[model samples]
Target: MAKYLIKSDATIKAAKPKPAPYRLFDGDGLYLLIRPDGKKWWRLDYTIAGKRKTISIGVYPSTGLSLARDKAKGARALVAANTDPSDARKAAKVKQAEANEAERRVAEGIPLENSFEAVARAWYAKKSSSWVPSHGDKIIRRLERDLFPWLGARPIGEIKPPEILAAVRRIEARGAIETAHRALTNCGQVFRFAVAEGHIESDPTRDLRGALEPVKGGHMAAITEPAKVAELLRAIDAYRGSLIVRCALQLAPLVFVRPGELRKAEWAHIDLDAKEWRFTVTKTDTGHIVPLAPRAVEILREVQALTGRGRYVFPSARTSERPMSDNAILAAMRRMGIAKEEMTGHGFRAMARTILDEVLHFDAHLIEHQLAHAVKDPNGRAYNRTAHLEQRHLMMRLWAGYLETIKAGANVVPLHGRAAA
Candidate 1:
């Protein structure tokens, strides 16, 4: 028989709480502690490094006899290995907590390498710094609105081409054909990024080529002929609309920016004395300088007298707090009998691009730089937004003068690398 102070369950059951607490030792540092209040607990007493300590195993009869002995045995093993049993128990609890957390994460569908939302968000964080605020918002919106519902929790490594195709087709079904194409391209970029990072074996988008409808590319309608451009200029001068709308129409051909950029022009961005309009280009997220010609500057100065106290140079008719509607210029053109097939507000950009390069014979690179068309230098470096400022300043003035001549119905005259006379 094992040596013990109390050897039988009958003896423990027959004992009752007394006026003081006492122990019934089973053996080898294990005992039953009975309190004056009738509570009994299991405990282990041991000595380490010349000091004595105690560890609570549990309360009984909840702990039971055989289970208490097993716990005591495990604690003794720790003490024999020169580890404090209390410290060992604490370490086990910490380890168990970590295991529980990992299991919960698995049950919640989180993983180490394959979550599409995880990888996509990482990629967005890496790239959003170089993009405009609006552009970044659009990227996140595209994923949340169109892709996340279907594939966010799916593993990037396990996502096949069929899943990607289905997500894109759903967007196409909503009549967002252009958005569908853009979403697929974005997916391709993300998949390629994952492959390069070794998170996936290959891009699933590679197998999806030619599965979408081919986009038919067409140019924005513009009056490219010299006579037709002259007529358009004449019509703009004769437009009897709101003062702000007429002014915007007159300035459109001179600056020839995208319609949104022109309409959203703020008084804060223009400097009349400096003869410059400096603002961030919405499409590229880079600073762009529109060197104001005398004619363009005059138009701005006039509009400032009316709207200088407000934020936008062209405030909407409904409220001065907002910029004019994007369709303001286009609607004005229609009212003037310039059909949509003949011209649009965006047509000014094409008109200037064609006339500057083909009619006036200016350097194509100079014209492209002025158009903010992402031109590269001879060294293949991206041109700074302010690059070629001197050339652009002279080009704006000459272009304005050429428009005046065309408005006068003169023959197609080339500037011939000289200032317009």
Candidate 2:
């Protein structure tokens, strides 16, 4: 019997020096406990495993005798029904907390204010999970500077094709037709990423295929003429800037990779001792192998002595953590008096593409493999290139010899445009 309820006018009792368990009004089935030294607490009298169990509900007076009595009755019910009230209560609270958190996130997220720019960072973190590190910064930066400013905060679900089209119109308006197209692509990718992550219901940029204006210009010309190329190489050898400029000049002609690919070269990707460069991930956003040409090896070896300690091979001169400015090599060429008509940084790929096909007579697949084209294997699957090393090794040596001979101005002639011919 427990004296949980003290009837009016019941004689008030003083606790002895030693702690004793007391019951609320006789037979009330609730208990109050005082410790051996007057410390107090409430305990629910119960039974478990066929043995008596006393679960602490709370302290009396603080919890108050009435609350302790009610709590005791609840625990006693669990004992009678063969359940644990404490465990049940904890599980119930946990479930309620989870529900509350979900509700909070929903309450905070209005598809409008939680716009593309606002949530891009968290979205990028999710997107970058499977992406290679170098590509993460490139794609995100392009979006932040180009797309987010215009369309980021609009409720992604509410974003219409025309609304997206209008955003891209601003990019084209800035003389960035190619950039506008790329911005559209990026916009589509982000929305898709958002949709996949449950941030939005649909991608709005999908319908704007030809909505952005087309580029008016043609491809830049590559310089391969012995006299012109030699003049350019001669100028690069003397111009004063980062030693990386000289190294890039050598690697650019020898490897003939795109400017973007060359800039993101990471140490883990290149193995100079093995005379091979393995981009565990390639410029096409796929895995690629680069068989280091002798000149390519030599150039890397030199650049290594200067910047081996850094992450990017051609780290931006302005900032060690950044890649070399996309315009660094072209600017150097311009400084050496080479007009945009005479050559461009990207022109090196065209030069190699032409010479490797016409003069050297290399297989197109082998050439494309070296150039890191999005070449595919038999089932129309993305080709994982074992970069035609044996053939490339031979071709690269020959190409280096050919360039040297060109630099010496032997058997050299200026090129005429294909239409001119």
lDDT of 2 at 169: 83
Cα displacement (angstroms), candidate 2, residue 337, comes to 2.1
Q: Tens digit of lDDT per residue, candidate 2, span 347-366?
A: 88888888877765666777
Each candidate structure's TM-score, on Cα atoms with residue i matched to residue i, is 0.64, 0.60
Q: Which runs in model 2 stand beyond 4 Å of their true positions?
A: 1-122, 128-150, 194-202, 217-221, 224-227, 240-242, 260-274, 282-286, 300-327, 340-342, 412-421
Which 10-residue span in candidate 2 carries the lowest summed lDDT? 412-421
Local distance difference test, each candidate: 0.86, 0.71
Best by TM-score: 1
Candidate 2 positional error at 60, Å: 37
Q: Residue 281 lDDT in model 2?
A: 48
Best model number under lDDT: 1
Candidate 1 per-residue lDDT, tens place, 202-301, comes to: 8999998888876543335888898999999999999999999999999999999888889889988998898899989877887889999999999988
List the pairs of residues colliding in candidate 2: 2-24, 3-23, 3-24, 3-25, 4-24, 4-25, 116-152
